[model samples]
Target chain A: MSELAQALDTLARRRLGGDAATGLARMTAGATQEIWRFMLVKDGAETPLILRRAPGGDRVSESATGLEIEASLMEAAEAAGVPVPHVKWVLTPDDGIGHGFVMAFVEGETLGGRIARGEAFAEARKVLTRQCGEALAAIHRIDPAAFPTLKRVTPLEFVTQYRDGYLASNWPRPVFDLAFRWLLDRCPPPPENPRLVHGDFRNGNIMVGPDGLRAVLDWELAHVADPMEDMGWICANSWRFGVEDKPVGGFGLREELWAGYEAAGGEKVDPERALFWEVFGSLRWGVMCCGMANSFRTADPSVERAVIARRTSETEIDLLRLLAA
Target chain B: MQDQPTPSEILGAVARFLKEVVVAETKGATSFNVRVAANALEMMRRQLDTAPAAEAAELASLKALLGIENEDEGGDLATLNAELARRLGAGELDLKTPGVADHLWATTLAKLSVDQPTYWGYRAALAERAAPTET
Candidate 1:
């Protein structure tokens, strides 16, 4: 058995009280983390669970909220009526595995392309914009004061980090430089009422079923900032999956998203601020594309990241549309 | 002076093989990756065919905009771009500066031409170019 399987077996026997766990396979090809779905059998009953963990040891970066913290965040969100998979077990040292948590496997299509374009999701697409808004409202309603572990960042701080990241990549795309300077020059003042922002909230992070939005996933970049950040991120062109006309995850209009957010009692939907962040979001994705390519040369050498590097130009054009004529 | 097939032709041949032969043999995620790999080869082919002229134009624009002659003489595109980035980051040049916006627009358009000609934003820009000029 693989080390992961053995550890999972141990974890299952101890925590889940399962007789066996079979069909351990990777859920997706992730650049930063490993996700595995398996069936735990106890008394001839089967339970589906997902294991999420960093591939290496716990060298948590400043931006990451850490797996343990993420597990706790999921619990908090679940309790607060946000749709998240129920976390069952958080790894301990005795589990003899790297940092990770296990949760009840939520069944849905998480692929952005399918969620945006597939015919099967026609109904889901109809409800996604409003559901996305409602979910964000629930997420933002989670009081940051309750969870001190969640990083609190101001707009300036995040912009500086992005600028530093671009510099670190050393790719020297001047268009990114222009966008970065533009963001710095126009950085919005700190929101009067800061709330929990799903820092990476967008198409792929959302899981959808034929019914509607099933679960909001991937809290790795969750932080406390302007709640509008979440709204702007969803409207970013990168998440549209080529359905450029539909701003809300390529499934619905911005007005529909705004209406949904307003209906959910989210802070009055700020169109101007959202537009600003939309521009910032495009530049951010451009920087991230370069970062992925840099990772291809640096720590993680994956063809996926290498291909994504070429996508920086897509963002460049996105920036032009947002910033210039 | 390599032989007759040329770099872009070689890239086109490999892309065709990946799309036609390898893609047919593969299934599931590998199939998706084969298509992505083929697309990357197409991008490379475009880059190889277009980069020299684009780089030369970008270099000339950078020299004029930054008011520096021979600043990039001993340097490559990456180095010259890094210098420009440093200046832009330091606020020495901005949209208000002469030629800055035009240079960025032209350079980014050049990049889209090579990396993603069919991207919606690029297509929109092309449409705008084709539109009749207002009085």
Candidate 2:
């Protein structure tokens, strides 16, 4: 057995009361996280569980909110009616597996393109927009006291941050320059009651079923910010795949998402501020695409990383669509 | 001059091979990556065909926007683009300026033509440009 499998077996033995962790396989889902699928066996009973561990082996950046913290956030989110994988065990120092947690494996489609276009999700498509809104409202409604450690990043702070990122990238793209200028000039004030914003709410990050949304995935980017930012981030064209007309994750409109949010007890939707963040989201994705491209040269020079540089222009065109007269 | 069976022609062959042959042989992650590789090659082939003219057009626009007389002296497209970005960042030029918005729009459209012509945003921009509508 590999060291990871042994540790997982140990972890299963200690916490899950399972004799062994069998059928261990690495799942290639999230690019930056280590996802392992395994079945824990205890007394002839089997339970499928997923292990989400830190990436890059012992290089947890300062921005990482710690796996324990993420596990706890999932617990709190479950309480707030947000669908998430139930975090079962957090690795102790004795496990020697670095930072990670085990959760009950979620079953659903996570592919953005498939969810947007596949006939399998045809039923899910009808209710997904409202469900997403409701889910976001629930996530935002979670008491801040549950996660005091999460950083509070307002629009202005992140806009300036992306601008700095673009500058550091030394990109000569004029659209990015114009986007930074436009966002900085019109940065909205932080919400009166700053809520827990799912910093990376989009199609791929969400798991859906034939019925509707199953669970919202990827809580690593969770932070405190305006609730509408969630709505706007989903509406960003980058998340739309090729279905441009259905802006809300290429499944529904912004108004429908806002309706679901409001119906679920979120604040009245501000179309203008949401539109601003939509623009903000586009530029942010653009800068992040460039970041991936930058890493292609030194850190990881895979063909995948090299070609992602071309996708930066996809975000550029998205920005133009939003900001153009 | 570059010889016949040019760089683009070679890329086209490789892309066809990957899409038709290599892709069928691979499975799982390797298959997905082979597809990505083939698409990248196709994108490169498209860029080779379209990018030079687009770059020339963008250079001409940048010179006009910056009010420069000599292309040889004013620096190449990359440097001129850097200046444009800097000026925009510093508030020296803005959308109100005659050529700023148009230049930005045209340059981005040109880039999409080479980078991702099938991208939804690119198609939308093309459609909107073809017919003005309240979208």
Q: Estimate each model's TM-score.
A: 0.90, 0.95
Model 2 / residue A206 / CA error / Å: 1.1
lDDT of 1 by residue, A230-280 (tens): 898898988888887889888989888888888887889868888878888
Q: Which docking class does model 1 fall in?
A: medium
Q: Pairs clashing in candidate 2?
A: none
lDDT, residue B82, model 1: 86
Give per-residue lDDT, candidate 2, residue B55: 84
lDDT of 2 by residue, B1-135 (tens): 979999999999999999999989999889999999998998889889988988899889989999998867789888999999889877789888998889988888878887788888888888988898775
Candidate 2's displacement at residue A227, Å, is 2.1
